[model samples]
Target chain A: MTFATRFRKSIEYQVVEELSRSVRWDANRIVVNTDAERLAGVCEALAKAGGIFDSAVLSSPASTRVPQVCYAFRMPDLGLGVSVFARGKNITCLSTRLDAAAWDERKIKDLAGVQLDGLEDARPLLAHPESGWGDFAEAVSKNRQTVLKPSEAYASREYAMEGTGADGEFEIPVGPVHAGIIEPGHFRFFVGGEDIHRMETRMFYLHRGLERQAVGRHVQRILPLIEQVSGDESVANAVAFAQAVEDLEGIRVPERAESLRLVLLELERIYSHLADLGGMATDVGFYASSSQFLLLREEMMRQNAALSGDRFLRGVVSIGGVDRNATQENLDATADALASFSKAFDELESMTLSSSTFLDRVFTTGKVSAFVADELALVGPVARASGKSCDLRRHFPYGAYKKRAVCESMAASGDVLARFNVKANEVKESARLIRSEINQMPSGPTHTGEKRTGHGFGWGWCEAPRGSCSIFVRTDKGRISRLSIRTASFRNWRGLERAVNGNIIPDFPLINKSFNLSYAGTDL
Target chain B: MHELSALLRAPRTDEISEEATDPAIRKVAALLRRRSGGVFSRSIHVRMVDAGSSNDVEVEEGLMNAPQVDCERFGIHFVASPRHADVLLVSGPVTLNMRRALEKTYAAMAEPRAVVAAGDGACTGGLFKHSYAVYKSGRVDEVVPVSVHVPGNPPSPYDLVAGILQAGLALDKKEAAKSGKS
Candidate 1:
C-alpha cells in the first residue's frame, strides 16, 4: 500500500473511537465528521497526534445545507491530509491554542458572519469599514440589493492600532497607497527613534469579492477568475484550482498535460524569484546587479509569452488539463533560452555576493527566527530560509512532482541574505527541473475530455512561487457552490509583521522586498 | 591607473534610431510634442495610483521603467508624490475601500494634471464589474475624470508609455484652458 493508504488505514480505527464514527476517505484525505462542541477537542487531539495545521474554511448556510466549517491538517511523515468537518453557526475558536489558525478564523468570521466563541482578535479582516457594502454575508443573502450607506458615514470609520506606549516610542503610519510600484497595504510601526518596537499590517484594499463571485459559476469558468488572484502567481493558482475541480470529479489528467503543467509551474517559479532577487538588489542600491537581474527577468517573461500567448501565462490552464499544448519547437526554444539565462544568472549572483555594500545591507537584517517561523506557520522561501522543511511539493507531491525528486533549498539564519540565497537557489533548481521536463516531454492528448459532473468537495494544493497555495472546492451537479483559497501571502504576512519587529526604519523597504508577499492574492 | 583603464574600456553609447522606437509610442510622443509646443517632450512627471488591480498593471508599470523600455528617455518619470506630478496614472476597477484613497490621490495632484486608466479593469472593471465590493464597475473614470484609457487585460509597457504620453497631451490642453480662463 502507499504511504497515504497505510496511514489512513492506521488512523481509521482511532478516528472512529475518538473523533467520529463517520470516518471515511476522500482520495488521500481522511474526512472525519464531528459535533461543533467537540471541534476544538478533536483538533487538539489531531495536533497532539502529529497533525500540523494547514487551513480552515467556512462554507456558509444554504437552503439545502446548514453552515459548515472544515479544518484541514497535514501529516508530514505520511504525506496525508486530514479534514475535520463541523456543522454549526457558532464554533469554538482554534486560534486561542493555535497561532497559525488566527487569520484563518478571523477571515471565516468576517466573510461568513460565523460566530467563533473565545476568538482572540475579533476585528474585521477583509471587510474594511470604508467598503460601502458592509457585512458581506448579509449582503450576499440579500442578493446584493441592500442600500449602501453614505460615504461620509464610513469616512469616519477607522481601524484600531495599539502601540507599545514606551517612554519615547511613537507610531508611524505608512500606506494604503505606497511610494513605489507595488500593491496597497497599510503598515503601522511603533518605533523608539530608529528601532522598531512592534509593527501591525492592514491589508485587503484590493478585495473585490472573488470568493462570492465564484458561487453558482461552472467549475470551468472560474479558472480565469483564479488567475487574477496574483499577476505573477497566475499558473500556480490556476493549477491549484484546476486540481481541486479534478479531484472533486475524479478526472485523471493526461500524463502529457501533467508534464506540461510541471514545466509551466517551474517557469513561473523562476520568473517570480528573479523579481524578488532583483527587488532585493534594487532596495539595497546595487543598481548594476539589480538592472542585470531585471533584464534576465524580462527575458524570462518574453520566453513565457513565446511559449504561451500571454506574457503572464494566463488562459493556459483549464479544468481537466491545460488549454493548449506546447509544440516541440516551443519546448526547444525554452531549453535554449534557459541555458543562456543560467550563464547570465550565475555571473549576476557572483557579482551580488562579492559586493560588500549589498552584503552589509542584507546580512543579519530582518531576522525571523525558526521559532517565530514555526509559530506563525509561515510557508515558501520565508519558512525554508528559517530552517523549516515545509515544501508542499516534497511533502504532498501532486501530478509530475510525484514522480520526480525536488531538492529543497534551505537556510538557517532566516535573515534577508538567507531569503536571497534561498530564492536564488530555488531559481536554479526550477530551471533544472524545466529543462529536464522539456527533454522528456511526453506525447499524448493534453486533455482528458471527462464529463464535468460531480456532487462533492475536495482539496487541491500547489507550492506556488511564494509558498503553498491551497484551494477548497464544493460542487453540486457540475456547478461550484463554494470555494476558498489560502495563499502563501495570506500566511506569510503575519510573519513579515514579526520579522520587522526589531529592524530599523529605513531598512523596512528591503525587508518588505525580501518577503515580497502578494496583497492581491491575500485580499482575494 | 586600473580605474582609468576600466572607464576607458566601457562600451560606447549609441544614438536611438527611428527604427528602435515602437510605432505606437512614437505616434503618441509626436502628438504630445506637437500639442505642447515641445515643452512636455522634455519632462512629464507621472504619479501612479493603484485603485484596486490584481497587480498585473503595476508589474507592467515597473517594466516600463526597465532598461528595454526606459520610459525616462521619453521624459516620462514616475514621481513619489502626486504634488510633484504632471499626470496621474491610475489602474483599477475602483474598489469601495480604495475609492477614497483614489479620490485623495487625484485631489492631491496640481492643476493641469491628466489621468490615464491603465488596464481593462481600470477602464471597465474587466471581470469584477458586478461585484458588490467594487464601486460602480471598478472603472477609474467612475471616481476621477480620465484623459485616456489603455485597455488590455494589463497593457504592455509600450502601450502604457503611449497612454502616459496621451495624458501629457491632455495636460497641455488643461494648461491652455486654465490660461484662457485666467
Candidate 2:
C-alpha cells in the first residue's frame, strides 16, 4: 500500500479511533466528514498523525445544502493532502488550535457569512467601508452581470489597531498611497521610542472581488482574469489555474507542454527575483548595483516578450493547453538568452555579496525565528530561508516536476541577508533546471487530453519566485463553483509582523522589500 | 568582448523618439519644443497612484527608470508627494477603496497638472470594472479627469514615456482652457 493508503489503513485498524469512522479518499484528496461535536478530537488526532494545516475552504449554501466550511491538511511524509469538511452556518474555529488558519477563517467569516464560534479576531477580511459586505453572492454568482455594491457604509469603516497593552505607545501610519511606483497598502506601526511593539497591516485596498468575479465564470474564460490576481506572478498563477482545470476534467498534459510550462515558470522566477534583488540593493543605497540588476531584469523581460507575445507573458496560457507554440526554435532562442544572463548574473552576484556595506545592513535584520516560521506555517523563500524544507516542487511533484527532481536552495538564518542568499541560489537552480528540461524534452504535438463537460475539484501548485502558490478549483458543470487562490505572499505576509519586531523603523523597508508580499494576491 | 557588454551595448528598439513620430506624440513634441524652445523641463515631476491595475503598468513604470529607458535622463522624475508634481500617473481600474485616495492625490497637485491613465484598467477599468469591489467603471477619468490615456494590458516603458510626454503637452492646454473659462 502507498503511504496515504497505509496511513488510512492504520487508522481503520484503530491507530486513531476517533478519525477511523470519518475518513475516506476521494481520488488523491482524503475527505473526512465528522459531526461538529467530534470535529476537534478528529482534528487533534489528524494533526498528531502528521497533517500540516493548509487553508480552510468555504462555500456558500446551495438551495438544498447548508453552507459548508472545510479545513485542508497536507500529510508531508505521505505525499497526500486532504481537507476535513463540515456543513454548517457556524463552524468551529480551527485557528484556535492551528495558528496558521486564522487569516483564512477570518476571511471565511466575511465572504460566506459563516461565523467561526470561537474565533478571537472579529475584523472584516474583504469588506471595506465603501464596499460593505460585498453583496458577495451577486459578485460571484453566474446569473449576475454587474457586481452588487453596498448602499451607504453599512459597517465599521476604520481599521482598529488593537493595542499590545504597552504603555506610552504611539502610532506611525504609512501608505495605502505610497511614495514610489508600488501598490497601496497601509501599515500602522505601534511603537514606543522607535522600538516597534506591534505592526498592523491593512490591505484589501486592492481587493477587486476576484473570487466573486470568478465563481460562475467558465473555467476556460478565466485565464486572463487569473493572470491579473498578481501581475508579477502571472505565469505561475496561470499554470496553477490551468492545471487545476485539467485535473478537474482528468486531462493529461503532453510532455512537450509540460516542458514549455517549466521553462516559462523558471524564466518568470528569474525576472521576479532580479527585481527583488535589485530593490534590496536600492533600499540599501547601493544605487549602482541596483541599476545593474534592473538592466539585467530589463534584458530578461525583453527576452520574455520575444518568446511570448506579451511582456508580462499574458495570453500565452490557456486551460488544458498553451496558446502560443513553444517550438524548438523559440526554446533555442530562450536558451541563448539565459546563457548570456547566467554570465552577467554571476558577476553581479559576486559584486553584491562582496559589498560589506550591503551585508551589514541586511545581516541580522528582520530575523524570523524557525519556531515562529513553523507556527505561522510560512512557505516560499521566507520559510525556506528559515530552514523549512517545504518547496512544493520538491514536496508534491506535479507537471514537469514529476518527471525530474528539483534541487532546492535553503538557508538556516531567517534574516534579510538569508532571504537574499536563498533567492540568489534559487535563480541559478531554476536556470539549470530550465536547460536540463529543454535538452531532454521530447518533441510532440503540444495540445491534447481535455474533457469539458464533467466536473470535480482539484488543487494545483507551483513554486513562484517568492514561494509556493496553490489554487483550489471546484467546478459545477463547466463553470467554477468556488476558487481559492493562496499565494506564497498570503502566508508569509502574516509572518512579516513577527519578523519585523525589535528591528528599527528604517530597516522596515529593506525587510519589507525582502519579503515582497503581493497586496493584490493577498487581498484577493 | 564579453557577451554581457554586447547585450548592454545593444541599441534599444523601444525608445521614444527625440523627434516625434506617432501623431499624438508629434503634437506633444511640438508643444514641448515651444515650452522650452528645445530645452526640456529641468524635471517633469510625476507622482503615481495605483488606482486598481493588475500592476503591469507599475512594472513598466519601474522599468522606465532602468538604465536603457531611464526616465530621469529625459528630465521626467517620479516624486514622493503629489504636491510637487506637474503630472499624475494613475494605473489600475480605480477600486472603490481607492477612489477617494486617487481624488485626494489629484487635489493635492499644483495647477497645470495633467493626469495620464497608464494601463487598460485605468483607461476603461480593463477587466475589473464590473467587479463589486471596484468603482462603477473604475476609469481614472471617472475619478480625476485624464489628460492622456496609454492603453495596453500594460503599455510598454516607451509607450508610458510617450504618454507622459503627451501629458506634458496637455499642460499648455490647462493654461489655455483656464484663460478660456475666465
Candidate 3:
C-alpha cells in the first residue's frame, strides 16, 4: 500500500480505538476516558505513529458546569489532529509524565477550576490568589449571557510566600507599569542585593475578552479583531485563525489567494522579527546596530501601509481569502522592498554578530534546559533554542507551507544570543521565500465566494513569530458553535519562568527580549 | 518617517517670536524646566497606556523628540508599564479591558500622582465610542480622573512634554492639597 493509504488507515484505526474505549467519542472527536496512568502510554503510542503533541487547553464548555481538559495531538503522516478529552478525576498532575503538559495543567487549575491531582508546581499560572480563579471563570462564563459582554476578568490576587525566607530577602515588585512602552505584566523578584532568588510574573492586566467577543460573531468579523490582539503580530494570528476555519469547512482557497497569503505571511514575519532583533540590540546599548534595524523596520511598515492601506496589515485577511487583493504594482513594490531589506539586513547582521558587547550580554543568558523545555513544551524560537526539534510549518504543513518547504531554524545554546541568531537568520530566509513566491505568481481569484459548510470541525495553524498559533472552530449549521485559539505565547510563557531562574534581576529584560512573547496574546 | 517630517515642519514657540513671553509659553517653559525627572530614575521611562484610538500616525509621531522638549536630556524613558511608573500618560478613550488597568495603575502609584490624557481618544472617545469594547464614552476622566489633557490625534512630542510636566505639577499640587487638608 502507498504511504498515503497507510496514513489514512492509521487515522481510521485511531478513531475506532478511541470510540471503543469510551462512548463519549461518539461526536467524531477522539474522546477517551483513560486514567491518569494511561496518559503516557497514549502519548507514546501516538508518537510512534508520527504524531506531534501540540498543546493541551484547559477550557470549560459554555453549557456544561464541569471543567474540560483537552489534549491536541497532531498526526503529521495523516495530516489529522485528534483532541483527546479526559473528563472527571483530575489525575494529580500530568506534567510529571508529559513535560509540556505541566504549566497548561496549572493554567487549567487556575482558570477552569480543575485540580491536577499529581501535577508538580501548583502555583497560579495567570491569576493571583486575591483574584480567585472562580471569579474569573464566572466572568468568562457570564460573557455568553450579557448584552454588552463582560470581558474576561483581569485580576491577580497576591499570594504570600509559603515558607519563611532568610532576613533581608527584600521583594522588588516591578510593573503592571514599567520603564518601557510595552504591555502590562507584573514581575515580583525575590532579591538579595542584585541577585534574584525567585522571579514571579503576574500578567492579564489588559485581558480584553477576545474569545468571548468573538463568540456568535461571523468568522469574517473575528479576523480584524484577531489582528489587533497584539499590535506587532496582527497578520500571523489572523492567517493562522483563517487557515483553521478554512480547514474545518473543507473549503479550498483560490490558488492566487494562497500564493498571496504566503507572500503576506512572510512579509509579516520579516518585519516582526526585524523589530525584535532591533529591540534586542537597543536593549543591550548597541545603538548603531539598533538604529539600522529601526530604519529597516520603518521601511517595511511603510511598504505594508502603501500596499494594504494599514501599516500593520490589519483587516487584510478574511475567511475565504484576503479582504483586499494586491495589484501588480503593490506586488512589485513589495518585491522591491524585500530586495533592499535583504542587502541592508546583511550589513546589520554582520555588525550585530561582530560586536563584542552585543554577544557578551545576549550569549549564555536566559537559558532554559533541554529537559525543562520538553516538559514545558515551549514553542516558536524558544522551543527551538533549547534544541527541541519542533516547528509547525515542518511538523504540520498548511497553506503554501505545505506545498513549498520551510527551511526551519533551530539553535542548541538556548540563550538570548541563540534566539537572536535564529531570528536574524529566519528574517533573511523569510525575505528569500517572499521573493521566490511572488516571482512565481499564481492566477485565480483571491477568494472563494461560496457559503461555508458549517456542520464540521475545522482546525488550522501558522508558524507565528512567537511560536505556533493554532485555532479550532466548530460550526453548527453555518454558525460558529465553539472556538478556541491557543497562541504561542500561552504555551511559552512558562518557559520564561524557567529561564529566569539563575539570572540576575537586571538581566531580566534581556532574557525577556529573547523570548519576546506577547502579554496580550497570552492574557486573551 | 513622513509623519515625523510633518511633526517637524509644524511651527513651535521658538519659531513664533511674538509668543516668547506669552503666558502659555511661560507655562510651557516653566513646565519644561521641572520636567528633568521622569518615570524611572535610571531612564526617562514614559509609560503609555493607550486606551483606544484610530489615529496611530499622530500617536506614533507624538513619541518622537520634536524640535523642543528634548526628553533624552532628562533621561525620560518610554515604557509600556504603569506599575513602576512615576507618571501615567493615557492615550485613547478608556476601553473595557483597559479601564481596570488604568484605574489600578493610578491607585498603585505612591502618593504623588500625575495623569496625562493624550490624543482625542484619551480625552474623548472619538470614533471608537460606538464600539462595544469601549468602557466609558466621552473621556478617560469618566473612568479615571485626568490631570492634564494633551489633545491631538496624538499630541506632538513637545506637547507630550508639556503634558508630562503638567502631570508633575499636578503631583505637587496633590501633595500640597493633602497637607493643607491635614
lDDT of each model, Cα atoms only? 0.85, 0.79, 0.67
Residues A133-208, candidate 3, lDDT per residue (tens digit)? 3354555556522223234344344555431275788888876655665655778887778877777777655444
Candidate achieving higher lDDT, 1 or 3: 1
| Distance from true location, Cα of A520 in model 2, Å | 0.8
Model 2 stretches with alpha carbons more than 4 Å out? A1-21, A36-41, A59-65, A130-156, B1-42, B176-182
Tell me what fraction of the real C-alpha contacts between chains A and B each candidate also makes.
0.54, 0.58, 0.12
State the DockQ, from 0 to 1, for candidate 1. 0.53
Q: Which residue pairs show backbone clashes in model 1? A: B92-B122, B93-B138, B94-B138
Q: Compare candidates 1 and 2 on lDDT and give the better one.
A: 1
Q: What is the lDDT of residue A29 in candidate 1?
A: 76
TM-score of each: 0.95, 0.92, 0.77
lDDT of 2 by residue, A99-121 (tens): 88889888877766676889988
What does chain B score (TM) in every candidate? 0.84, 0.79, 0.68
The candidate with the higher TM-score, 1 or 2, is 1
User: Per-residue lDDT of B27-61 in model 2, one digit per residue for the tens?
Assistant: 44454455563223455789999977777778889
Off by over 4 Å in 1: A1-17, A60-65, A130-133, A143-147, B1-36
**Most DockQ-accurate candidate:** 1
Which model scores highest in TM-score? Answer: 1
Model 1 alpha-carbon miss at residue B122, Å:
0.5
